[model samples]
Target chain A: MGELVVDELEVQKYQEQEVEENGLPLVLLYGPLSLLNVFGSESLLNNFRLIKPWESPEIPLHEYLITHAKNVKALVCLGKTELDSKAIHCLPSLEIVVTCAAGLNHIDLIECRRRGIMVCNAGNAYTIDGADYAVGLLLDVLRRVTSGDRYVRSRMWPLKGEYRLGSKLRGKRVGIVGLGSIGSEVVKRLVPFGCKISYNSRKKKPGVPYPYYSSVYDLAVNNDVLVLLCSLSEETFHCIDKDVLTALGKDGVIINIGRGPLVDEEQLVRFLVNGDIAGAGLDVFEDEPAVPRELMELDNVVLSPHKAVFTPESFIELQELIVGNLQAFFSKKPLLSLYKNALSASS
Target chain B: MGELVVDELEVQKYQEQEVEENGLPLVLLYGPLSLLNVFGSESLLNNFRLIKPWESPEIPLHEYLITHAKNVKALVCLGKTELDSKAIHCLPSLEIVVTCAAGLNHIDLIECRRRGIMVCNAGNAYTIDGADYAVGLLLDVLRRVTSGDRYVRSRMWPLKGEYRLGSKLRGKRVGIVGLGSIGSEVVKRLVPFGCKISYNSRKKKPGVPYPYYSSVYDLAVNNDVLVLLCSLSEETFHCIDKDVLTALGKDGVIINIGRGPLVDEEQLVRFLVNGDIAGAGLDVFEDEPAVPRELMELDNVVLSPHKAVFTPESFIELQELIVGNLQAFFSKKPLLSLYKNALSASS
Candidate 1:
């Protein structure tokens, strides 16, 4: 159940071996196993015959999809490739779209809805890891854990004598940018540390005990730390702007585990460099692999290379969620992780 | 109340201005303010006329205490100075000893008992910070937060591609040594992360839910991570030696927020270098400020400059505990942080 390839080689192997004997319906895999080559631990590779099409030297991706994947009822979308209208139109027989990610920014949900393609995502798979990484990054930045490690490794402790003291995490007001599942998990974890949590979401959540601010700037004004866990949309992109950073004040720290575009990278760098803000712990950047040179030089900021949710455990969970949702769709039973909004639109 | 100099200069100023004005009682302070120059935030420095002594070219510390500090009724012991029999003997008129630390290893408890002197320490002041740091170190070590920070800072993400995945911290069996206030707090913090907790203390604690192992070796064999938080005593010196390290196996992690020498530094260094243990997050070392040359080269270990409990909030709490206990003693009231065993012996 763990074979991973949205490419020619695995497809060739699967088609040759079990297509006729198993009589399993074919589903198209979207992309190759990208990061760490981890496609899915939960993929029942033998249960389904897999085929993929790419913009190739011989034939274009649209032609390949129409000719090779025409009868493919399920299309799996990995985060790498954009599943836009062009790609969706090529898969005319596609009934369900399964994505192994919590965020659906990569796939055009509206297009999928117009085609009546039921969409499901990895539900709660990365929530704990995302929350854990956010809290870990915040604690690391506040306590200077990474900086202290570097200082010790540089043999500065013997030369510099006493290191600087870290501020206490307890009693610090932490404002969460998104009060979704990841944000809620972060709140649960921070509760034990005695931190005061407030959140900013699209709307004021009913049952949430903490105060909610409709605007991100107001949330920044009252909190010592701002944790970004919300999705990246046109409206939400650069949500943490110069004004919000200013409102957060000089004692403010930012922990970004969500998409990098959630914070205005240029203004954030300016604030960080000029000491407008205290520090930051960023796992994501505006550009995926490219980080600002100024941030690289600063000791106050901790730079993580977008591997916050690369835990083997979470990947396993994602594999299960993806495979289970696909099976549920085929069985005509209730899909496990069907996008709630997608259901409302379909109805 | 916030003046921190423990040298002759503060003594002279206090003796002239405060001793006569308010008729404040005198107490001898130990050591200069070390590590972030944070002496105490809660210290009612004006509440008592402070005096201090040290062996210098001018006079020996014992001679300075006996001659210049004979009438002093109270002595304050900072962590830097060892309060052995010789130093304790120098304070002849001392009725009470107040220390701004949780550990009593630096002080001679037997001597304090023989002299009928009351000893109190900074109670629960550093507890939250210590626990927070221990958990922080654990999360950092397991998740490779500091190393990832280093990777991104070194500008290796583009060149090297995606960074290696860190093992999940959840579901890892963690064993704590010295399951007192700090260890208990650590357990509380780890609960939400879904980690399994176990411990090795001097004796099994009653009403505690976690499984207890009497020996460190047994604990190491049963757990994936071993956290050292026990007090360093003759019996516990080098408790986590080669055998324990071997038992912990190749994938084991160690988090030390307690005193150094709890784990054999030489053996630990060898194990770390040889890959006998997975990783370590060390805040304390066998020698203060002097880390091993070998440890400096490893990315698996996170080295802190022994400032885990140096947060200003805790420092303030330490100050308050020290002053509160002293005030309680002079007024014939209960000391805030009296050593429990001392009280037991006294009764």
Candidate 2:
């Protein structure tokens, strides 16, 4: 007994079983219904015990979370999942939350701060793709790419006549809302298209050459196109209201790749319908999966399911970052994409 | 007799009437069926006795041109109308042809040269808009902007869950077919999007830094995207055929803002239908508005009705150039935007 000399095969089998069941850390895979299956989450499964509460159809996510996922030390949240105080309280032992998204509006920073839990985001993974989508939306709306597609699809060109001419993108006065990583990239991309780039952020981005407007209204008043790339905060909520829309005027277009709530969707729809604004290219909605019905037939408004950061490249980058950040967290090494503002606030 | 006459009001009335009827140098508006009404041609009407054969509808264009337009000294052509030898023969006094388009494929350069007919095109008016459209199509195809619009329009997003993730536009290797003004602008636009640009012009463009592949096949082999910006000619007609498409491979996309026959339409349809290549964004087709029926159901292809260079800004610029060039020709001044290649070859 002291030397443990007997039945090494049985001992090895027992140890292997133990390691298989409990050796790796657990992570709550929180996202859309199809999240765990799609998005190449198998790599995460290889290293962590991934428990998706929504996978079990019989029980609801919150109940399942409280019952079975209490001990999970980490949560891997995807885009737009509400990770508030009540949800955080369900997982009592949760030490870190890693979001596979650029936006963190769903995460409760105050609650997470009070509990002293760490947070990680997708970092620069979304920056390039987000910027690309923003510009793509702007181009699509300006050139009527989507409308032209619809007209062609309906066989309208031959039957009726040529599709109406769209306004040019070159030399457009573009105002970027939020000169963050993604917004900066948007400015860069639009620059070579001959667009005059300016921006509105919470504060002046030091050393940036693009003209900066202090308020969203001032930005809207000056620009022919307002690209909404700012995050949704209390101050930023419904920031693109009727005042901003009116300021943007009849010829101006709005491109929203940020959170839906960042825009006043109802007002936007009314503006778009009444021709108060020229058009909109929206990737996110006020209530996702519930786009305004009026937008269905609009040639000007190009609606997209929130897919700005959902490119294959971004997903791969985010997956790697999630793994890297989690590994770093477990090793007590510096987390790759730690939300340092939140961490520093709590500290 | 008029100098000796004392009736000044009657003389002025006769003079105004004569000017209205035939005094202004006649210009045959050679274009599509509805071209006279669209495209801000009212300004053109003010400058010259603009005669439209298609507008009358009493006789066929050929017959109308023979009877009514034989005395016309200048012709203003719109896009894609066949101004070949046969059409040119009808207008015996056709000293010059001004096409309100970037492409001059329908103008029959060889025939025009043989007949001593000068031709002018839209000049740099199409350059900015053409580049904008090429990049727009590339972005739309890569980001599935048109497809996303369709999906949302079809109400498939909520029903079908999430739209599939597209590949990133960042870091794509792009091959531009022609390195003219528009193609050069396309390079400038795609640079900040992180695309690696190369080209296959007739010869290597001087002082350019991008890699130049002399052959289309080689260009297709190395690039993720092939943008057809070359004018359609004997050499470039059906240039993107089976070999070129195959070389482009399954992941490569084609954005054709050039003339229709620049690509072999039948082979492209087959490649797209069979998934031999990724996708295409086609503004022009082999036949004037008769898009392949097969492409109607495909999400991979985005079809446009040759409106790439038809933005409002371009129209105003083109209208001015059209009038300016005609005035210059009449005044024995150097023609603006003259197709010097065709002129030089003829001389």
Candidate 3:
């Protein structure tokens, strides 16, 4: 019996050494899609042994999570993953959750708070790229850049004369719906173009020199362009509806870089079709990966997939931030990018 | 005999009263396209009686010019019109020529100079719009804004996975080929986006903050993106050739908002096809209205129909400037937007 016990202990020690050759912490990455290692960050792989459960499509997700539950102290969630109470219960040893995206809509923040599971996100990592994209979409719509590209590609310029003139951006009143990181960056870019900036947010930020509006309708009424960059929550869902579109009027243009549900997309299509509103530059949709068919033919509207934050520079920054957060969490140091004041619960 | 003389005097007085009813100058407008009266600028009509040769297509152009030669003191030249030596000779009484376009390439400046005819262009009217369009094209190319728009419009998002990531604009080293009005405006707008700007112009602009490169090769080697916003002349034609493209390397992008001949179109097409360069955003082509069919299929290139300066606000401003120049000419004041030191002949 003593000889058998000694043999078992030696076998266990060898297995531990094989699994953690570099002595890095073991982190279980659970998500429907496996994107944690796609960037191939050397520092991340050198620091932690990321166990991606979704890599083996044959294995059931629950079984995989249970297999690593005892040793896994951290979970890395991708954008599409949902961390409900059941998933949280399965990860009994999980002390922290790290998301590689800015939005936390997929994560059950309430459950995380209840369980005291610290969460870190890619905070301000996507802000500049997202803001730059919003401006690009707006310029594409107002100046017909995409439509012009199509016309040239279709071999129509030779047949047609000069293209029809587009609207100008200088001196136009631009009302930003959100004054967060992305929206504030948008304001900074537009200022140099001579665009008049205004805003309407959850609460008036003190000392912001831009004119503040109490409501979206009021903001639309006075501005030539309305740019949506606010967060997605219950109170903000469909915040840009038919009434706001009607108030925006025929000469008004709207740009939505935020989540799609923030605007009543169906009404927006109707307004665009009827020529009630001048134009729109949309980067997000109500049902993403599925935009309205009516928008495809409209020359006045510019459509883009939800790729406002997908840039190589931004991805590099995000990878660095993610690596930093994980290292900090394991060391019991302050989380690098913990989104404080979780207001969506109240919203 | 006395009664006959008195009857002739009454006839002359009636003709004088009819001509002076508006008290406006008689300005001869010669072009295949009639665009002067289209804007319906009452101020222009109140200031001068514009004689449009293209209005009566049935009449010969020479006959029309000869008919109005004696009374015409000013001439308005549109884009398609060729005011060569012969045309200038026909209008012996022409004192001033007004073109509502930024480029005066269509006009025979040598002939005008020989005749001592003052020429006024659209000047800074198109500066703001042109700069905005250049920035828009750069953004579209670097961020894949137009391609993403097409991806959504083609209904490829649902079928395909996430679109490929794009290069970010932040921290990019941009090289402006010409630091004139439009290029300067582009530098101003790009500053807020964290782009480091440099330039290569006719001469190093005194007191300009941007670093100046004496040669295009040096500029291409150092910068990540090269923008062509210089005037197209003999010296500048095909300036961005194979050598410059090679130096720009595989990761560089080129934006041409200037005349198309500024860059070698064939070399550009080859470079783009072979991936020698990352991408290109071209608004003007070597031949207007006739873009290379090869460029149509390339996903990295953004094409426009030479519409960089085409905007309603800019057109409105151009109309006002044209009127102001004509008024200033008639009143014998300094020309508002004259092209001093016309150097295309030497170029």
Q: In model 3, what lDDT does residue A231 have?
A: 81
Poorest lDDT segment (10 consecutive residues) of candidate 1 chain A:
A13-22
Candidate 1 per-residue C-alpha lDDT over B165-244 given as tens digits, one digit per residue, 9 for 90 to 100:
77888789999999999899899999998899999999999999999999999999999999999988898999989999
Per-model TM values vs. the true structure = 0.93, 0.90, 0.92
DockQ, every prediction: 0.57, 0.46, 0.45
**Model 2 per-residue lDDT tens digits across residues B1-347:** 01122133532332212123655676777776355445565566567766666556779878887887777778888666778888888878888998877777778888778878899988999899889888888888888888887777788877777887778998999999999999999999899999999999999988999999999999999999999999878899899999999999999999998988888999999999999999999998998688999998999988888888778787787778989999998888999999987777544
Predicted structure 3, TM vs. truth: 0.92
Q: What is the TM-score of chain A alone in each candidate?
A: 0.92, 0.90, 0.90
- The positional error of residue A63 in candidate 1, measured at the CA in angstroms, is 4.0
Identify the superior model by DockQ, candidate 1 or candidate 2: 1
Q: For candidate 1, what TM-score does chain B get against the true chain B?
A: 0.93
lDDT of 1 by residue, A1-347 (tens): 13333455655656522133366767787765442148552255656766645424387777778777777888788755678899888878889988877888888888888878888887888888888888899889998899999889888888877777778999999999989998998998899999999999999999999999989999999999999999899889999999999999999999999899999999999999999999999999999799999898898999998877768888888777877887887788899888887656544
True C-alpha contacts between chains kept, each model in order: 0.77, 0.77, 0.83
Clashing pairs in 2: none
What interface Cα RMSD is found for model 3? 8.2
Off by over 4 Å in 3: A1-22, A32-34, A342-347, B1-22, B37-41, B342-347
Off by over 4 Å in 2: A1-23, A31-33, A51-71, B1-23, B51-72, B90-93
Between candidates 1 and 2, the one scoring higher on TM-score is 1
